[model samples]
Target: MIARAASALLVASWLVVGPTPAAQAAPATATCTSSVGPGIPPPAGLAAGVPGFHAQWYGQSGYPTLCPGERSTATVAYYNSGSRGWVNGRMGEVAYLGTWGPEPGQDQVTPLGGDGTNGSPATGWPRYNRIAIQPAPYVGPSQVAWFQFTIQAPVQAGSYRLYLRPLVEGATWLEDFGVFWLVTVLNADGTPPSPPAPPVLGTGYGFQNVATARGTFGVHLVKERLADVTVKTLTANTTECLNNCPAKPLAQYAAETNAYAGMNGTYLCPPDYAACAGKVNSYDYAVYNSTLRRWLNYNALNGQNGLLAFNGTTTSVYRRSFVYFQQQTPVTAAITNYPLLLQNGAVISSEAEQSASQLAKGTKGAIGVDGTYVYLVIATNANVTDLAYVMQALGARDGLNLDGGGTAAMWIGGSYKVGPGRLLPNAIVLTKP
Candidate 1:
């Protein structure tokens, strides 16, 4: 009788009203489970032969699996080898790409890893499954595979789950699988996205409405904009404004407010790097500083604004014009006592070694500060209201419109906030004192 009733409900749910609510609802009690078995081990001592890699299932333990538009209920973790041997000189780094469903197609993903880097190893090898003429030779005696994906609540208002397994020699390698780590994605930020609508601001060259100044506003910090400026040298005791224009000369420096001629003033760039700077489209970038233990960016609130927090210090917090950002790993690592950087967004020539288009047009992703909290946004078919809400809910006290239309991105700042090392034209910087 219960089975018949369930079948009737299923049929009525499918035919009579909208979609099936039960089908869309997340599983109330789900657990992630897995087992492991030994396989042909690595030959011996070579770093490549180390047993750091293992097969594991994510979310097999009890947790809510997530998808876009679904509230984050669980956080899952995967681990690499215990030591550094798992990482190669520059070739053996982790790479990831997202998808709508567990199918073999690059529908939403880009041809390359968003940028030209291709995220290929030293010998043009991908860390996970590869699609080419033939499988790239795995010279090492052993090989490990990793898979990652996330689900957001607003993207789809339905309960969803994903199953991950390894593929070997065109076959499913389920027996050798083992369980590794698992974490939970939670609603740390109580806010949710508002439905979509037209953008609050317009698409113009100059910005007229600066962030509200009525309240105690923090210093106006712009990500690095490549612009020209007048240079002046001041004496130790002379705390006066001094300006030396390229052609004309003056002894007084312009005040921060005066820098803008007036509302709709012509966009300006700093006199540092000669790349296009000033008033980029809606977007912002933040870099995680391990030493300072905070997210760092150009602080426009300070009086003297030259690389405000460059060279291992966060004291310089002023000298911003607009904002820009690049995507990077969630944590920071050290090579020469300096953080390891990479490209994860848009590709522009002036961006230096950074990939100019790491997070460019129409792409959607999430960002979090402390590992326990996170916020995800959907670019495609998402309204500005919803976007604003999600960001705020995720602890973005003050956030800006990152380049969207696929260029949107976020990195989990569990350890170090990944940084794309170029100045964006416009960015929304956070101001939490």
Candidate 2:
């Protein structure tokens, strides 16, 4: 037997789209071919021969309009009405909001929400709060799960993304497939925010390195520079753009062209100075291609291969994305530029860079910085190489790992990329306008 229900309002809207052939209201309940909902058994048949299925809703607590805090939760139940084989699968995704576009401090990002470990746990069952995947109690397969640390609400709001999937378990406790959920939540002020005016899509391909003091940030599109990247503003003069000037800065470069090095020329900085110093450099999260090389796992941390970075409601670095910045004026602030990588303080220099040791460990993931925003990437497959590739493809100059394995998820650009997490987390959001 199959059952279904429309959220009432959605049904009403569907009726208004156009006159139905019969004009009769659509059925409120439809026969579900497979198990789908909060803690329920898989139907007679599904993609695989797993059983158990279910779904639920979660709401965030009091959060301000300019800056929001949010939370999410769901329940799962399994029964012995199906197959005798134990189930191993992943969960679905929940919708959330974020911003994107071209504006000063304007965030043009693909954000990943914030969720983390619930509490302390030494062994056996996975710790609470962090993202993970495990057998659904009495179900047919494993489901993705997550536990939010805080409620997150954004200042500007708009449709966002969410994705979820179920995976088949392997010999070593790893999953193979799962669902992807996409959802969008409203802003605190009631309505969603508008996307920023579109940027003049540039045709010529080139790199830009923008710098600024303090909290100021901006992106410059360069052309004909040797290093492939040059610093310039998209709108204002260099003088006025004391920090992020778009126009005049071009002329200033011309007058003092001799003072600056050739575009292709490399500039040297103290070796100890972090990864992004002295040069307008960037990191690319190249996709993982296992055909040629083998990915190494973390051998020192008791078989744990990677770390996590949380960005839910409570933490100061919550819900951010990666990008570059230049100040409007010269200012002094404690700034440390490096690839936003994270680790549990374990050194893995022989295999990777020392930065790898900085990844968030024990519980969740890590966070990376670009200008004023934060770029976050969570993992579903604990493969660190896979995580690095995804980040690079997403345009991260210096990437870091957020919670992964079962704890990876992202809610941005009106979409969601959830992997095996049971609970959802807040996100580093981006506004449109």
Candidate 3:
């Protein structure tokens, strides 16, 4: 009965209601970015490999900031290495996708919006004994399979994980190939996004609307006037870089640090290099957090400039000298990477490595300072050069290019001003003291 009910709801949700709301539409100038990447391995508890099944989770697609109790579709794809193909069986005796962990080793799930009883969650799948989504991929032995899931963030506000793994209904569980992401669901109730705390200085650092050349982009802006507001680099673990794995979802870092907003930080070591910075987990890029008072990692300039937080107060953009000269006074935060974008109000060439800039050309993330207001900008349909002009137009005294393309995104004002479509290496974030 629950399975039937879930199927009915799935049918209703699949039908086109009306025109895609403006909010649902990708920005006009947005570029195509694959939300799919190597799926991070299942949380520590998963076994090494499935004997008969081999599944590689590509990644998933969704806005980073999800509103509580809101229903949206997250698209995830995986490569199938099993002997049999996935099929939708009448009694659900075929291969299908199942949940990974509310705990490890549990290859079961209640359909979204359903209680634990009823039929298999995979029964909600639209096809019969098959798997695919629009712009379908060839799915079979060693081929790629894509699945679209309509998920709802729990009513409560927090970062939550909705894991997916493949299984053969009534037959046997497949290997523990996992695909999941940490979603930061904000509490807006039924109303517009609301800030967690009252605004500081009448306009605290959060999401603020900003007009751009193409359209209005909400920038995650931190007010220099507000005291106790801090900006830090966000990655998996706070204050340290981990080796050999991809960066965690932004929500994980934010929830851990209790940050108000998160945006992609500087580019990391070249993708082709075996080590990110000469070691798997150790960072090769230069970064420092003033509030944390730690030198996370350091490397020489790669023809790159930096965004620096000095004395735990002021922020500045400088050349390679900070590293060579060695400061007497304590420096709070220093981030160095890539080609400088804007220096002294003039646009410069991009320093992004070739690997990161190939296909994606959509909305990009950047940082610029205009007096006391430090801005995190997402330029719609712009490249690094275009981002520099954007900062100059915003009247920035100096600006630094952050990792853009798919790595681009901003979360503020209780919503994703510009949502990151991919998991990133690091981010610059704001927090309340």
TM-score of each: 0.20, 0.22, 0.46
Per-residue alpha-carbon lDDT of candidate 3 for residues 324-407, written as tens digits (9 for 90 to 100): 336534565556655556777776655344233422333456777655666666654344555666677666767776765435
Candidate 3 residue runs with Cα over 4 Å from true position? 1-228, 234-242, 245-247, 269-283, 300-305, 321-329, 351-360, 413-416, 420-425
Better of 1 and 3 by TM-score: 3
Ranking by TM-score: 3, 2, 1
* Candidate maximizing lDDT: 3
Residue-wise C-alpha lDDT for candidate 2, range 327-400, written one tens digit per residue = 11121111111233332222122224323322211112333333323333343212334344333433443444
- The number of the candidate with the highest TM-score is 3
All-Cα superposition RMSD per candidate? 21.8, 22.2, 13.5
> Measured by TM-score, how close is model 3 to the native structure?
0.46
Candidate 2 least-lDDT 10 residues: 261-270
